[model samples]
Target: MVDTKLKFGVHIRRAADKAAKMTTALSRLMANTRGPRASRRRVLMSVVHSILLYGVEVWADSLSIAYHRKRLAAVQRRCALRVACAYRTVSHEAVMVVAGAIPIHLLAKERKEVYQKKGQPGTRATKKEESREETLGRWQEEWDAAQKGQWTKRLIPRLGPWLGRSQGEVDFFLTQLLTGHGAFRAYLHKMGRARSPMCLHCGDAQDDACHTFFVCERWAGWRRAVEDELGRLQPETLVLKMIESDRNWKRVATFARAVLSEKRMELASQGPASHEGTSSSEED
Candidate 1:
Protein backbone atom coordinates (compact mmCIF):
# COMPACT_ATOMS: atom_id res chain seq x y z
CA MET A 1 0.00 0.00 0.00
CA VAL A 2 2.88 2.36 0.80
CA ASP A 3 4.90 2.57 -2.44
CA THR A 4 7.95 4.45 -1.18
CA LYS A 5 8.11 2.24 1.91
CA LEU A 6 7.94 -0.89 -0.26
CA LYS A 7 11.12 -0.01 -2.17
CA PHE A 8 13.61 -0.30 0.72
CA GLY A 9 11.62 -3.21 2.21
CA VAL A 10 12.96 -5.56 -0.48
CA HIS A 11 16.29 -6.05 1.32
CA ILE A 12 14.88 -7.61 4.47
CA ARG A 13 12.19 -9.39 2.49
CA ARG A 14 14.90 -11.06 0.42
CA ALA A 15 16.56 -12.48 3.52
CA ALA A 16 13.26 -13.38 5.15
CA ASP A 17 11.99 -14.94 1.97
CA LYS A 18 15.15 -17.02 1.70
CA ALA A 19 14.76 -18.09 5.33
CA ALA A 20 11.10 -18.97 4.92
CA LYS A 21 11.97 -21.07 1.87
CA MET A 22 14.77 -22.81 3.72
CA THR A 23 12.51 -23.50 6.69
CA THR A 24 9.90 -24.98 4.42
CA ALA A 25 12.38 -27.17 2.60
CA LEU A 26 14.14 -28.35 5.72
CA SER A 27 11.16 -28.78 8.00
CA ARG A 28 12.07 -32.42 8.47
CA LEU A 29 15.49 -31.40 9.71
CA MET A 30 13.72 -30.13 12.81
CA ALA A 31 12.83 -33.71 13.74
CA ASN A 32 15.89 -33.96 16.03
CA THR A 33 17.21 -36.79 13.90
CA ARG A 34 20.60 -35.10 13.63
CA GLY A 35 23.32 -35.87 16.16
CA PRO A 36 22.21 -33.67 19.03
CA ARG A 37 20.54 -30.36 19.80
CA ALA A 38 24.02 -28.94 19.23
CA SER A 39 24.13 -30.35 15.71
CA ARG A 40 20.74 -28.84 14.87
CA ARG A 41 21.84 -25.48 16.26
CA ARG A 42 25.04 -25.63 14.20
CA VAL A 43 22.89 -26.29 11.15
CA LEU A 44 20.67 -23.38 12.10
CA MET A 45 23.66 -21.06 12.61
CA SER A 46 25.93 -22.29 9.81
CA VAL A 47 23.18 -22.59 7.24
CA VAL A 48 20.01 -20.73 8.23
CA HIS A 49 21.43 -17.74 10.09
CA SER A 50 24.22 -17.40 7.53
CA ILE A 51 21.60 -16.89 4.85
CA LEU A 52 19.47 -14.61 7.05
CA LEU A 53 22.27 -12.24 8.04
CA TYR A 54 23.79 -11.89 4.58
CA GLY A 55 24.28 -8.18 3.85
CA VAL A 56 22.00 -7.40 6.82
CA GLU A 57 24.33 -4.61 7.99
CA VAL A 58 23.23 -2.60 4.99
CA TRP A 59 19.85 -2.32 6.66
CA ALA A 60 21.64 -0.24 9.32
CA ASP A 61 20.53 3.07 7.86
CA SER A 62 16.93 1.89 7.81
CA LEU A 63 16.80 2.48 11.56
CA SER A 64 16.57 6.21 10.89
CA ILE A 65 13.76 5.44 8.45
CA ALA A 66 11.03 4.22 10.84
CA TYR A 67 8.89 2.18 8.45
CA HIS A 68 11.81 0.26 7.02
CA ARG A 69 13.22 -0.32 10.52
CA LYS A 70 10.03 -1.90 11.85
CA ARG A 71 9.79 -4.23 8.87
CA LEU A 72 13.42 -5.20 9.23
CA ALA A 73 12.98 -5.87 12.94
CA ALA A 74 9.93 -8.02 12.27
CA VAL A 75 11.82 -10.24 9.81
CA GLN A 76 14.66 -10.86 12.25
CA ARG A 77 12.28 -11.60 15.12
CA ARG A 78 10.58 -14.29 13.04
CA CYS A 79 13.92 -15.78 12.00
CA ALA A 80 15.12 -15.92 15.58
CA LEU A 81 12.08 -17.93 16.63
CA ARG A 82 12.59 -20.45 13.86
CA VAL A 83 16.31 -20.76 14.59
CA ALA A 84 15.69 -21.35 18.28
CA CYS A 85 12.81 -23.78 17.57
CA ALA A 86 10.80 -21.86 20.10
CA TYR A 87 7.07 -21.39 20.02
CA ARG A 88 5.69 -18.34 18.25
CA THR A 89 4.23 -17.33 21.58
CA VAL A 90 7.71 -16.85 23.04
CA SER A 91 8.98 -13.28 23.40
CA HIS A 92 11.37 -12.13 20.68
CA GLU A 93 13.91 -11.22 23.36
CA ALA A 94 13.69 -14.72 24.85
CA VAL A 95 14.05 -16.24 21.39
CA MET A 96 17.14 -14.17 20.63
CA VAL A 97 18.68 -15.06 23.98
CA VAL A 98 18.30 -18.78 23.36
CA ALA A 99 19.44 -18.44 19.77
CA GLY A 100 22.54 -16.47 20.85
CA ALA A 101 21.48 -13.68 18.50
CA ILE A 102 21.52 -9.96 19.03
CA PRO A 103 18.54 -7.84 18.17
CA ILE A 104 18.64 -6.90 14.48
CA HIS A 105 18.15 -3.22 15.20
CA LEU A 106 21.05 -3.28 17.62
CA LEU A 107 23.12 -5.24 15.15
CA ALA A 108 22.46 -2.54 12.57
CA LYS A 109 23.42 0.10 15.09
CA GLU A 110 26.70 -1.69 15.84
CA ARG A 111 27.46 -2.12 12.15
CA LYS A 112 26.77 1.57 11.60
CA GLU A 113 29.36 2.38 14.24
CA VAL A 114 31.93 0.23 12.45
CA TYR A 115 31.01 1.75 9.11
CA GLN A 116 31.40 5.28 10.44
CA LYS A 117 34.72 4.32 12.00
CA LYS A 118 35.92 2.90 8.67
CA GLY A 119 34.92 6.09 6.89
CA GLN A 120 36.71 8.34 9.36
CA PRO A 121 40.23 9.47 8.59
CA GLY A 122 43.12 8.63 11.02
CA THR A 123 40.80 6.52 13.29
CA ARG A 124 42.76 3.30 12.73
CA ALA A 125 46.08 5.10 13.20
CA THR A 126 44.82 6.43 16.53
CA LYS A 127 43.50 3.01 17.62
CA LYS A 128 46.74 1.32 16.49
CA GLU A 129 48.60 3.07 19.29
CA GLU A 130 46.09 1.87 21.93
CA SER A 131 47.47 -0.76 24.30
CA ARG A 132 46.57 -4.48 24.05
CA GLU A 133 45.26 -4.20 27.60
CA GLU A 134 42.90 -1.44 26.51
CA THR A 135 41.67 -3.57 23.60
CA LEU A 136 41.00 -6.54 25.89
CA GLY A 137 39.22 -4.28 28.33
CA ARG A 138 36.97 -2.95 25.57
CA TRP A 139 36.32 -6.50 24.36
CA GLN A 140 35.47 -7.67 27.84
CA GLU A 141 33.08 -4.76 28.24
CA GLU A 142 31.28 -5.69 25.01
CA TRP A 143 31.13 -9.38 25.98
CA ASP A 144 29.78 -8.50 29.39
CA ALA A 145 26.98 -6.63 27.67
CA ALA A 146 26.19 -9.36 25.08
CA GLN A 147 22.99 -10.69 26.64
CA LYS A 148 20.78 -9.80 29.58
CA GLY A 149 20.89 -12.27 32.48
CA GLN A 150 22.88 -15.52 32.24
CA TRP A 151 25.03 -15.17 29.11
CA THR A 152 25.62 -11.48 29.82
CA LYS A 153 29.10 -12.19 31.12
CA ARG A 154 29.56 -15.21 28.89
CA LEU A 155 32.00 -15.05 26.01
CA ILE A 156 30.80 -17.25 23.16
CA PRO A 157 33.85 -18.31 21.24
CA ARG A 158 34.23 -21.34 19.03
CA LEU A 159 34.39 -24.82 20.52
CA GLY A 160 37.93 -25.94 21.38
CA PRO A 161 40.39 -27.14 18.69
CA TRP A 162 39.94 -30.77 19.69
CA LEU A 163 36.22 -30.52 18.97
CA GLY A 164 36.94 -29.34 15.45
CA ARG A 165 38.98 -32.51 14.95
CA SER A 166 36.53 -34.87 16.71
CA GLN A 167 34.81 -37.81 15.06
CA GLY A 168 31.08 -37.80 14.08
CA GLU A 169 29.79 -39.63 17.17
CA VAL A 170 31.97 -37.49 19.38
CA ASP A 171 30.67 -34.43 17.59
CA PHE A 172 27.07 -35.58 18.23
CA PHE A 173 27.80 -36.27 21.88
CA LEU A 174 29.33 -32.85 22.30
CA THR A 175 26.38 -31.29 20.53
CA GLN A 176 24.01 -32.93 22.99
CA LEU A 177 26.02 -31.67 25.93
CA LEU A 178 26.57 -28.17 24.59
CA THR A 179 23.06 -27.59 23.30
CA GLY A 180 21.60 -29.41 26.31
CA HIS A 181 19.03 -30.92 24.01
CA GLY A 182 19.52 -34.30 22.31
CA ALA A 183 20.07 -36.56 25.31
CA PHE A 184 17.69 -35.01 27.81
CA ARG A 185 14.51 -37.09 27.83
CA ALA A 186 12.76 -34.32 29.76
CA TYR A 187 13.46 -31.98 26.88
CA LEU A 188 12.31 -34.46 24.22
CA HIS A 189 9.18 -35.23 26.21
CA LYS A 190 8.52 -31.53 26.51
CA MET A 191 8.89 -31.34 22.75
CA GLY A 192 6.26 -34.16 22.54
CA ARG A 193 8.24 -37.00 20.94
CA ALA A 194 8.97 -38.68 24.25
CA ARG A 195 6.38 -40.12 26.62
CA SER A 196 8.11 -39.53 29.94
CA PRO A 197 11.26 -38.09 31.53
CA MET A 198 11.90 -41.00 33.88
CA CYS A 199 14.57 -43.56 33.07
CA LEU A 200 13.07 -46.73 31.60
CA HIS A 201 15.84 -48.79 33.24
CA CYS A 202 16.26 -47.07 36.58
CA GLY A 203 12.53 -46.10 36.80
CA ASP A 204 12.79 -44.24 40.12
CA ALA A 205 14.34 -40.99 38.98
CA GLN A 206 14.19 -38.61 36.03
CA ASP A 207 16.28 -39.65 33.01
CA ASP A 208 18.14 -36.47 32.27
CA ALA A 209 21.37 -36.92 30.32
CA CYS A 210 23.50 -36.24 33.38
CA HIS A 211 21.67 -38.81 35.51
CA THR A 212 21.89 -41.50 32.84
CA PHE A 213 25.55 -40.92 32.03
CA PHE A 214 27.12 -40.20 35.42
CA VAL A 215 24.87 -40.85 38.42
CA CYS A 216 22.56 -43.65 37.25
CA GLU A 217 23.09 -46.99 38.92
CA ARG A 218 22.04 -48.73 35.71
CA TRP A 219 25.05 -47.47 33.73
CA ALA A 220 27.74 -48.07 36.39
CA GLY A 221 29.44 -50.87 34.50
CA TRP A 222 29.45 -48.94 31.24
CA ARG A 223 30.69 -45.85 33.05
CA ARG A 224 33.51 -47.88 34.63
CA ALA A 225 34.49 -49.28 31.24
CA VAL A 226 34.43 -45.78 29.80
CA GLU A 227 36.60 -44.51 32.66
CA ASP A 228 39.00 -47.36 32.01
CA GLU A 229 39.23 -46.31 28.39
CA LEU A 230 39.84 -42.70 29.35
CA GLY A 231 42.29 -43.69 32.15
CA ARG A 232 40.34 -41.44 34.54
CA LEU A 233 36.96 -41.02 36.16
CA GLN A 234 34.99 -38.10 34.76
CA PRO A 235 33.76 -35.74 37.41
CA GLU A 236 30.07 -34.87 37.78
CA THR A 237 30.65 -31.24 38.59
CA LEU A 238 31.31 -29.03 35.55
CA VAL A 239 30.62 -32.08 33.40
CA LEU A 240 28.81 -30.30 30.59
CA LYS A 241 31.48 -27.62 30.53
CA MET A 242 33.89 -30.37 29.49
CA ILE A 243 32.59 -29.95 25.95
CA GLU A 244 33.91 -26.40 25.82
CA SER A 245 36.99 -27.25 27.86
CA ASP A 246 40.04 -29.22 26.64
CA ARG A 247 39.70 -31.67 29.55
CA ASN A 248 39.47 -35.06 27.88
CA TRP A 249 36.24 -34.18 26.05
CA LYS A 250 37.02 -36.76 23.36
CA ARG A 251 36.97 -39.59 25.88
CA VAL A 252 33.82 -38.12 27.43
CA ALA A 253 32.19 -37.98 24.04
CA THR A 254 33.09 -41.55 23.13
CA PHE A 255 31.83 -42.85 26.46
CA ALA A 256 28.66 -40.74 26.61
CA ARG A 257 27.81 -41.58 23.02
CA ALA A 258 28.16 -45.29 23.67
CA VAL A 259 25.72 -44.95 26.55
CA LEU A 260 23.40 -42.77 24.45
CA SER A 261 23.40 -45.31 21.63
CA GLU A 262 22.64 -48.15 23.98
CA LYS A 263 19.90 -46.10 25.58
CA ARG A 264 18.33 -45.37 22.23
CA MET A 265 18.35 -49.03 21.30
CA GLU A 266 16.86 -49.85 24.66
CA LEU A 267 14.15 -47.24 24.27
CA ALA A 268 13.29 -48.49 20.82
CA SER A 269 13.10 -52.11 21.95
CA GLN A 270 11.26 -51.56 25.21
CA GLY A 271 9.15 -48.65 24.02
CA PRO A 272 8.97 -45.39 25.99
CA ALA A 273 7.41 -45.95 29.44
CA SER A 274 7.57 -44.86 33.07
CA HIS A 275 7.26 -47.94 35.23
CA GLU A 276 7.15 -47.18 38.96
CA GLY A 277 7.39 -50.81 40.14
CA THR A 278 10.05 -52.03 37.70
CA SER A 279 13.61 -50.94 38.37
CA SER A 280 16.32 -52.71 36.39
CA SER A 281 19.55 -52.69 38.43
CA GLU A 282 21.94 -52.48 35.44
CA GLU A 283 22.39 -50.77 32.11
CA ASP A 284 20.34 -52.13 29.26
Candidate 2:
Protein backbone atom coordinates (compact mmCIF):
# COMPACT_ATOMS: atom_id res chain seq x y z
CA MET A 1 0.00 0.00 0.00
CA VAL A 2 2.70 2.46 -1.04
CA ASP A 3 2.18 5.43 -3.35
CA THR A 4 4.16 6.64 -6.38
CA LYS A 5 5.84 9.23 -4.13
CA LEU A 6 6.66 6.46 -1.58
CA LYS A 7 4.21 7.99 0.88
CA PHE A 8 2.25 5.63 3.14
CA GLY A 9 -1.05 7.44 2.48
CA VAL A 10 -2.39 4.33 0.79
CA HIS A 11 -1.41 2.21 3.76
CA ILE A 12 -3.21 4.52 6.15
CA ARG A 13 -6.36 4.43 4.07
CA ARG A 14 -6.24 0.64 3.89
CA ALA A 15 -5.87 0.37 7.65
CA ALA A 16 -8.79 2.73 8.21
CA ASP A 17 -10.92 0.76 5.78
CA LYS A 18 -10.04 -2.55 7.42
CA ALA A 19 -10.80 -1.15 10.85
CA ALA A 20 -14.11 0.31 9.67
CA LYS A 21 -15.05 -3.11 8.31
CA MET A 22 -14.28 -4.66 11.66
CA THR A 23 -16.53 -2.09 13.36
CA THR A 24 -19.36 -2.95 10.98
CA ALA A 25 -18.91 -6.66 11.59
CA LEU A 26 -19.44 -6.12 15.30
CA SER A 27 -22.31 -3.67 14.82
CA ARG A 28 -24.80 -5.93 16.58
CA LEU A 29 -22.77 -6.03 19.78
CA MET A 30 -21.97 -2.33 19.63
CA ALA A 31 -25.53 -1.23 18.89
CA ASN A 32 -26.43 1.67 21.16
CA THR A 33 -29.69 0.14 22.42
CA ARG A 34 -28.56 -3.37 23.42
CA GLY A 35 -25.11 -4.62 24.47
CA PRO A 36 -22.95 -3.46 27.36
CA ARG A 37 -21.06 -0.24 26.59
CA ALA A 38 -17.97 -1.46 28.45
CA SER A 39 -17.88 -4.62 26.35
CA ARG A 40 -18.28 -2.56 23.17
CA ARG A 41 -15.39 -0.35 24.28
CA ARG A 42 -13.23 -3.41 24.90
CA VAL A 43 -14.01 -4.84 21.46
CA LEU A 44 -13.20 -1.47 19.90
CA MET A 45 -9.80 -1.29 21.63
CA SER A 46 -8.87 -4.96 21.27
CA VAL A 47 -10.06 -5.42 17.68
CA VAL A 48 -10.89 -2.33 15.61
CA HIS A 49 -8.26 -0.12 17.16
CA SER A 50 -5.70 -2.86 16.93
CA ILE A 51 -6.36 -3.15 13.20
CA LEU A 52 -6.10 0.63 12.71
CA LEU A 53 -2.80 0.87 14.58
CA TYR A 54 -1.33 -2.44 13.48
CA GLY A 55 1.92 -0.87 12.27
CA VAL A 56 1.52 2.65 13.63
CA GLU A 57 5.15 2.70 14.83
CA VAL A 58 6.31 2.88 11.22
CA TRP A 59 3.83 5.48 9.91
CA ALA A 60 3.42 7.33 13.17
CA ASP A 61 5.50 10.14 11.75
CA SER A 62 3.03 10.50 8.91
CA LEU A 63 0.34 11.51 11.40
CA SER A 64 1.95 14.96 11.41
CA ILE A 65 -0.09 15.41 8.23
CA ALA A 66 -3.58 16.36 9.36
CA TYR A 67 -5.26 14.45 6.55
CA HIS A 68 -3.65 11.17 7.53
CA ARG A 69 -4.58 11.67 11.16
CA LYS A 70 -8.21 12.52 10.29
CA ARG A 71 -8.53 9.45 8.10
CA LEU A 72 -7.72 7.21 11.01
CA ALA A 73 -9.69 9.36 13.45
CA ALA A 74 -12.87 9.05 11.40
CA VAL A 75 -12.72 5.29 11.82
CA GLN A 76 -12.25 5.60 15.57
CA ARG A 77 -14.95 8.27 15.77
CA ARG A 78 -17.59 5.86 14.45
CA CYS A 79 -16.82 3.33 17.15
CA ALA A 80 -16.61 6.01 19.83
CA LEU A 81 -20.06 7.34 18.99
CA ARG A 82 -21.44 3.85 19.51
CA VAL A 83 -19.51 3.38 22.74
CA ALA A 84 -20.88 6.58 24.24
CA CYS A 85 -24.35 6.10 22.75
CA ALA A 86 -24.13 9.74 21.77
CA TYR A 87 -25.87 11.62 19.00
CA ARG A 88 -24.18 11.81 15.58
CA THR A 89 -24.00 15.60 15.97
CA VAL A 90 -21.50 15.50 18.84
CA SER A 91 -18.01 16.77 17.93
CA HIS A 92 -15.12 14.35 17.67
CA GLU A 93 -13.26 15.86 20.63
CA ALA A 94 -16.34 15.83 22.89
CA VAL A 95 -17.44 12.32 21.89
CA MET A 96 -13.94 10.92 22.43
CA VAL A 97 -13.86 12.35 25.91
CA VAL A 98 -17.31 10.99 26.79
CA ALA A 99 -16.47 7.60 25.27
CA GLY A 100 -13.18 7.35 27.18
CA ALA A 101 -11.31 6.85 23.93
CA ILE A 102 -7.95 8.51 23.34
CA PRO A 103 -7.37 10.67 20.29
CA ILE A 104 -5.92 8.68 17.38
CA HIS A 105 -2.94 10.97 16.81
CA LEU A 106 -1.93 10.93 20.47
CA LEU A 107 -2.36 7.18 20.62
CA ALA A 108 -0.16 6.82 17.56
CA LYS A 109 2.52 8.95 19.17
CA GLU A 110 2.28 6.83 22.33
CA ARG A 111 2.76 3.66 20.32
CA LYS A 112 5.76 5.17 18.58
CA GLU A 113 7.31 6.19 21.86
CA VAL A 114 6.70 2.77 23.39
CA TYR A 115 8.33 1.12 20.40
CA GLN A 116 11.35 3.44 20.69
CA LYS A 117 11.77 2.49 24.37
CA LYS A 118 11.62 -1.27 23.66
CA GLY A 119 15.22 -2.24 24.44
CA GLN A 120 16.02 0.17 27.33
CA PRO A 121 13.20 -1.01 29.57
CA GLY A 122 13.34 -2.54 33.08
CA THR A 123 10.22 -4.53 32.28
CA ARG A 124 7.88 -4.36 29.29
CA ALA A 125 5.08 -3.68 31.76
CA THR A 126 6.94 -0.85 33.46
CA LYS A 127 7.80 0.89 30.20
CA LYS A 128 4.25 0.55 28.95
CA GLU A 129 2.87 1.95 32.22
CA GLU A 130 5.25 4.92 32.07
CA SER A 131 4.29 5.62 28.46
CA ARG A 132 0.58 5.60 29.34
CA GLU A 133 1.14 8.04 32.20
CA GLU A 134 2.98 10.42 29.90
CA THR A 135 0.22 10.15 27.31
CA LEU A 136 -2.52 10.79 29.87
CA GLY A 137 -0.62 13.82 31.16
CA ARG A 138 -0.46 15.29 27.68
CA TRP A 139 -4.15 14.51 27.14
CA GLN A 140 -5.13 16.29 30.36
CA GLU A 141 -3.28 19.41 29.31
CA GLU A 142 -5.11 19.41 25.98
CA TRP A 143 -8.45 18.83 27.67
CA ASP A 144 -7.94 21.85 29.93
CA ALA A 145 -6.99 24.11 27.03
CA ALA A 146 -9.62 22.90 24.60
CA GLN A 147 -12.29 25.42 23.60
CA LYS A 148 -15.01 23.00 22.55
CA GLY A 149 -16.91 20.85 25.00
CA GLN A 150 -16.45 23.40 27.79
CA TRP A 151 -19.39 21.82 29.59
CA THR A 152 -17.80 18.37 29.53
CA LYS A 153 -14.47 19.78 30.73
CA ARG A 154 -16.21 21.34 33.71
CA LEU A 155 -17.52 17.90 34.77
CA ILE A 156 -14.47 15.79 33.90
CA PRO A 157 -11.42 17.97 34.48
CA ARG A 158 -9.14 14.95 34.73
CA LEU A 159 -9.25 11.92 32.41
CA GLY A 160 -7.35 9.63 34.80
CA PRO A 161 -10.03 9.46 37.49
CA TRP A 162 -12.86 9.06 35.01
CA LEU A 163 -11.12 6.30 33.05
CA GLY A 164 -10.03 4.55 36.24
CA ARG A 165 -13.60 4.11 37.45
CA SER A 166 -14.70 0.45 37.42
CA GLN A 167 -18.48 0.81 37.79
CA GLY A 168 -20.48 3.49 35.97
CA GLU A 169 -21.94 2.71 32.59
CA VAL A 170 -22.34 5.06 29.59
CA ASP A 171 -25.72 4.98 27.90
CA PHE A 172 -27.75 7.49 25.83
CA PHE A 173 -29.21 9.41 28.77
CA LEU A 174 -25.95 9.47 30.68
CA THR A 175 -24.00 10.45 27.58
CA GLN A 176 -26.36 13.38 27.06
CA LEU A 177 -25.72 14.54 30.63
CA LEU A 178 -21.96 14.08 30.26
CA THR A 179 -21.54 15.70 26.82
CA GLY A 180 -24.36 18.29 26.71
CA HIS A 181 -25.03 17.29 23.15
CA GLY A 182 -28.46 15.66 23.26
CA ALA A 183 -32.17 16.31 23.92
CA PHE A 184 -31.44 19.54 25.82
CA ARG A 185 -33.29 22.47 24.27
CA ALA A 186 -30.19 24.69 24.27
CA TYR A 187 -28.19 22.20 22.23
CA LEU A 188 -31.10 21.44 19.93
CA HIS A 189 -31.67 25.14 19.31
CA LYS A 190 -28.00 25.61 18.61
CA MET A 191 -28.15 22.79 16.09
CA GLY A 192 -31.20 24.40 14.38
CA ARG A 193 -33.48 21.58 15.48
CA ALA A 194 -35.56 23.56 17.97
CA ARG A 195 -37.36 26.94 17.99
CA SER A 196 -36.04 28.18 21.30
CA PRO A 197 -33.40 27.48 23.91
CA MET A 198 -35.69 28.16 26.86
CA CYS A 199 -36.56 25.14 28.93
CA LEU A 200 -40.00 23.76 28.26
CA HIS A 201 -40.18 22.59 31.86
CA CYS A 202 -38.57 25.46 33.76
CA GLY A 203 -39.43 28.29 31.27
CA ASP A 204 -37.33 30.67 33.39
CA ALA A 205 -33.86 29.63 32.15
CA GLN A 206 -32.16 28.24 29.10
CA ASP A 207 -32.43 24.46 28.94
CA ASP A 208 -28.75 23.54 28.89
CA ALA A 209 -27.07 20.69 30.67
CA CYS A 210 -26.44 22.70 33.83
CA HIS A 211 -29.93 24.14 34.02
CA THR A 212 -31.61 20.80 33.44
CA PHE A 213 -29.40 18.78 35.76
CA PHE A 214 -29.06 21.19 38.68
CA VAL A 215 -31.48 24.10 38.35
CA CYS A 216 -34.65 22.87 36.64
CA GLU A 217 -37.56 22.34 39.03
CA ARG A 218 -39.03 19.67 36.77
CA TRP A 219 -36.48 17.14 38.00
CA ALA A 220 -36.54 18.25 41.63
CA GLY A 221 -37.97 15.00 42.85
CA TRP A 222 -35.29 12.89 41.16
CA ARG A 223 -32.60 15.40 42.03
CA ARG A 224 -33.70 15.40 45.63
CA ALA A 225 -33.53 11.61 45.64
CA VAL A 226 -29.87 11.77 44.63
CA GLU A 227 -29.05 14.70 46.95
CA ASP A 228 -30.64 12.81 49.83
CA GLU A 229 -28.00 10.12 49.34
CA LEU A 230 -25.04 12.27 48.17
CA GLY A 231 -25.08 15.81 49.66
CA ARG A 232 -26.08 18.90 47.70
CA LEU A 233 -24.71 18.43 44.16
CA GLN A 234 -22.77 20.77 41.91
CA PRO A 235 -21.16 20.22 38.50
CA GLU A 236 -17.68 20.34 39.99
CA THR A 237 -18.37 17.66 42.63
CA LEU A 238 -20.82 15.49 40.66
CA VAL A 239 -18.17 13.31 39.05
CA LEU A 240 -16.33 12.91 42.36
CA LYS A 241 -19.50 11.77 44.06
CA MET A 242 -20.39 9.45 41.20
CA ILE A 243 -17.06 7.66 41.28
CA GLU A 244 -17.12 7.38 45.06
CA SER A 245 -19.07 4.10 45.04
CA ASP A 246 -21.03 1.78 42.77
CA ARG A 247 -24.27 2.75 44.47
CA ASN A 248 -23.49 6.43 44.04
CA TRP A 249 -22.67 5.90 40.37
CA LYS A 250 -25.92 4.08 39.77
CA ARG A 251 -27.90 6.79 41.54
CA VAL A 252 -26.45 9.55 39.40
CA ALA A 253 -26.97 7.57 36.22
CA THR A 254 -30.50 6.73 37.32
CA PHE A 255 -31.23 10.42 37.77
CA ALA A 256 -29.89 11.14 34.29
CA ARG A 257 -31.94 8.33 32.77
CA ALA A 258 -35.14 9.39 34.44
CA VAL A 259 -34.83 13.08 33.67
CA LEU A 260 -33.53 12.80 30.12
CA SER A 261 -36.06 10.16 29.17
CA GLU A 262 -38.85 12.49 30.21
CA LYS A 263 -37.24 15.39 28.37
CA ARG A 264 -36.94 13.35 25.17
CA MET A 265 -40.54 12.24 25.32
CA GLU A 266 -41.77 15.77 25.94
CA LEU A 267 -39.69 17.20 23.11
CA ALA A 268 -41.03 14.59 20.75
CA SER A 269 -44.58 15.51 21.66
CA GLN A 270 -43.92 19.20 20.88
CA GLY A 271 -43.25 18.65 17.17
CA PRO A 272 -41.09 21.02 15.07
CA ALA A 273 -41.26 24.82 14.97
CA SER A 274 -39.63 27.78 13.23
CA HIS A 275 -36.43 29.24 14.70
CA GLU A 276 -36.89 32.20 16.99
CA GLY A 277 -34.56 34.88 18.36
CA THR A 278 -31.02 33.75 19.21
CA SER A 279 -29.40 34.02 22.61
CA SER A 280 -26.17 35.98 22.99
CA SER A 281 -24.69 33.78 25.73
CA GLU A 282 -23.79 30.10 25.55
CA GLU A 283 -24.96 27.54 28.11
CA ASP A 284 -22.62 25.81 30.52
Q: Which candidate is the best by TM-score?
A: 2
Point to the candidate with the largest lDDT.
Answer: 2
C-alpha local distance difference test of each model: 0.50, 0.79
Clashes of 1: 0
Alpha-carbon TM-score of each model against the true structure: 0.54, 0.89
lDDT of 1 by residue, 14-39 (tens): 76678667655664555333423543
TM-score of model number 1:
0.54
